[model samples]
Target: MACLIKGVYIAEIDRQENRREDKQIAPTWWEAFHFKCIKVLEDDVDSSIFGAVFEYMGHQIESPKYVIAIRGTMIKSRTAIRDVYMDAKIALNELSHSSRCELALEAVEGIIGSTHHTNVWLAGHSLGASIALQTGRDMAKRGYYLETYLFNPPFLRLPLEKIKCRKIKDGIRFMQSFVKAGVSLVRKKTEEYDPFILLNSWIP
Candidate 1:
């Protein structure tokens, strides 16, 4: 289930990229999920990071939930490689947070400040996952709790002793539990299912 959700966010990122390239105005897959794009966040100062804010309204809900989905490395050129390296540096805390990632988080904070919705979720893939985790940690420090879903996150070499914040440590543990439970559920459900059918149905 975690993998499925991650794939959905990745597909949304691809759709957003295609829309940008073609300059088309079309409904995205999020519409089917009852999510509408509220804001598209981009940083011209640092083009490596980009994200979108979505408002979700499910059938049983009277209020909306907000989601911030960040895009991962494009890897189309040398610049993309540089961006990935920067993400690694940020992960290791060798450098301060990436400007692009910081900008993206600030944008989300701005939206959250103005909105009444209390449920906020964050998601990203690869390098974007690193950014999301870092930003979520910062937000946690600021007393704004956010649930985060990261797919194939980069491994940071920081030791547990180096992390001073107990809240951040707890948050990390929570994310790990959430991911483990999701993987367990997915595996249990697919134990007797055909691999080809699962792949065809899940992969888009």
Candidate 2:
């Protein structure tokens, strides 16, 4: 599945470089698995292909009917700044407010509406993973659980796992839990948006 997602990245790079024939990644590589590119979602900021939708034409029982793969941050590229901006948004817990996230959710909803939710899968990496995670949560809230794979999703907190002392790590964990509980309580009482509560029914 990761290979198929990587094909999307390669296809975008080839598209940018004008590579074709045997060098093309979309039809050339995906055809091996009987998947065809159905749609290419572009970044509105730089017009770069950020997501690709692939439809499975094979009769294999394990194959997903459709797969939406989202590319992660491309370092040193034109979309890098926008990607980093989204990364910051994740850290700020504002990813749901991103236009790109909205686009991804809309795409997934369109597919699920046209076909069936059980036949679709979502996969993403890094910043794209954040988008995918948020989109999955949104779909789950709507009572549609789509299989999702997220690679290297960002964790918006200090790396407590790096701390050598167990006591300090436990202390930090306790404080973090306490703060989170307090925030959840406040949000619930105020009827504010609480994704954790909304995501209670989603496991993946």
Candidate 3:
């Protein structure tokens, strides 16, 4: 799998295929020992070849045991502030948008649910961070001990407002650090796809 965003992926292999890959076809216990060290969450599975310029924004490697939902482009959502981006408002509108969070929550409940979790971490990069923040808020309302990591969420609003949202900021820096290291190693080992060149800026 090749991902533009480092640890995240587009999910190429179906569940059945993944199972097959995990357990190789072997004769019997007498057969030669063979093992496959496979990492399903490699960068090769990411969405953009032009992923984060700041690889330090998102998650590192998520475990199957944990229900992790990552929102990609929340900027596309039709929020009340959609027109704020018009003309010179492109930057401001992006900051005020909340509709993307709605989509992210729906996706999380729809895809990552079914199995319950006491601790669920929702994360996103760039504009998606805002969505993650919103999702975390909703998850909290549902009584889930949700932790959200927003990677360089573009805060085009008043500095005070963005600062106010910092509680949800939670593991922003930590998440970026964790993911950046993973992306670097993956890129170095030829294990997965490359990350966005801008990742370094956010990591620091």
Candidate 4:
């Protein structure tokens, strides 16, 4: 799902670079995944698309109903200015107050409220990951826990991995093992049966 989201980002870049809508790759790529591009989200600053919402069309049991994918900072693109500004806001711990965060949060909420028994997923990378993380946290606080996937998310505090102290690293690792075990047990008890098999009707 992360890969698919990234593909949409790449296609958007391609679309902007060539200044042609037909050159976009998202449609073909999404078709392969049995998903349809339902919305292309634009940033308030430049009106350049920075996120996408895909609606699943496949008949796979338990597949997500919608996916909200956000693209990270692009150093050289139409959205570079907005992206860099958002990055700086993140560094300064002002992401929650930013419009980007609000936009993502609204998109996810819309999907959740649009229908009953909906399965929505969220994914983002780098700057986008920060937005996704914030959105997820906000949703959880509101009693809505959506499945979220983050790639290369920024850490506000000093990363533990970069610390030179072995004791701190070892202690963190030990605690992580315990946390993982507890999470595994919880998943086993609450998980629904999902075979992940796709229906033949949707195949090309």
Candidate 5:
């Protein structure tokens, strides 16, 4: 099966200064992720484009395992979530804790509900990657056969490498001036930007 690329936008509310507004990110915003997968049971990296990033980076999805890919919007993790947080501060909005979970859960449902039961591996660039890990855990708890690969997810330290990508509630954060600057500099339509497309380098 060839990898599938579907674009979607999710709504979010910032939780800092009291807000009830809806923000919309372009479907193309997700058209900007890139990733390569390492086969879990094999010694080789598949080199298949599993999701939107591959397309963003100018590649095509061509393999059985890469068949189900869904691109979601605006839920940036440390990489993109910071912008969500700061933007909320600017707009004076808030997300009740439950609402946050709803956002993630709904996304998980949307992604998984559209796929087959074959060996599942969840991978996302940033916040999307974090969600992928969360989905993996949920699927395991529900007895679904799945393996998850996260790319540049929020840095989480673990005694073991395999447990590094586990939960979203436990996601760790690091202050980054460079990320903030990039978000600020690229938000302007006049600035000529390609949605946040950072490399996959960071696992602990």
Candidate 6:
């Protein structure tokens, strides 16, 4: 799972960098696994958040999987700054809801509406992780089961006292349990390069 998350993160970076260059770079490990970018989700209303949907062709499974990967803060524009503010507001429970997260969820729903898939997975790093978690819960409410893989998530100490919504609190609790289980699954010590350390280095 850690390896998969790292591949997704690298792929996202590649996709962003490639957008600026004239010639596209070669595909990364995630793309090598037959994960092709199907849509890039960005709009005027939700300018703060950016995400991409990739269609993965399963080698063994009969059905395909859809993976939605979101990009974290880059400090490249006003929208990026707004998204960073949203992350802080969400952590402190200053806002009633997160618009950026909702936008990402809407993008996922749009993609899912167009195709049939076996399962949907969400992944992101830093601020993107928060959006992914919030989006996952929203999808859950809409009768969609989504598996999420978050890398180096911020706002670990979100103030529960500031949160007024009981449903939102419940969603946070569910996310905590889900993350804890994922951590347990990948707790084994390894002599190889640690993805956690790599993720930390990437974060500022």
Tens digits of lDDT, candidate 1, 1-204: 133234344544455465563453333456666777677665455443256777776764643487787666665542466566766686567523566677767866887787742577777777667777777766655556666788887775437577999999888879888998997788777865533333332211
* TM-score, structure 1 vs. true: 0.58
- Please provide, for model 2 over 1-204, each residue's C-alpha lDDT reduced to its tens digit, 9 standing for 90 to 100: 676678767777877777765767566667788998888888788777888889999999988999988888876566678878878898899989988888888899889888989999999887878888888988988888888999888886688778999999999999999998998788878653566666776775
lDDT of 1: 0.62
Give the winner by TM-score. Answer: 2
The lowest-lDDT stretch of 10 consecutive residues in candidate 4 is: 195-204
Q: Across residues 51-153, which tens digit of lDDT does each residue of candidate 5 receive?
A: 3322223354432233223222344332244435523432342222223223444444554575653423445444445445454554544545454555555
Model 1 alpha-carbon drift over 4 Å, by segment: 1-27, 45-49, 62-64, 91-96, 157-204
What is the lDDT for 140 in model 2? Answer: 88
Which candidate, 1 or 2, would have the higher lDDT against the true structure?
Answer: 2
CA lDDT of each prediction against the hidden true structure: 0.62, 0.82, 0.39, 0.76, 0.36, 0.63
Best by lDDT: 2
Looking at candidate 1, what is the lDDT of residue 76? 54
Give the candidate order by descending TM-score: 2, 4, 6, 1, 3, 5
lDDT of candidate 6 at residue 58, scale 0 to 100: 60
Query: Candidate 3 on 55-144: residue-level lDDT in tens?
Result: 112244442233343324422223213322221233544432333344456555653465554334455665445555556655654555
Our tally of clashes for model 5 stands at 10
Candidate 2 vs candidate 4, TM-score winner: 2
Candidate 1, residue 55: how far the Cα is off, in Å: 1.2
True-structure RMSD, every candidate: 14.8, 3.3, 18.5, 8.8, 19.6, 13.4
lDDT of model number 3? 0.39
Q: Is candidate 2 or candidate 5 better by TM-score?
A: 2
Worst 10 residues of 2 by lDDT: 190-199
Error of 4 at 22 (Å): 3.2
> Candidate 6's residue-wise lDDT over 100-153, tens digit each?
666777777876787642367788777777777677766655556566788777
Report the C-alpha lDDT of model 4 over 1-204, residue by residue, as the tens digit. Answer: 776667667766776777467766666767788998888777888877778888999999888888888888887757778788999898899999998888888888788878652488888888888887788777665556667788898776547879899999889889888998987777677555211111111110
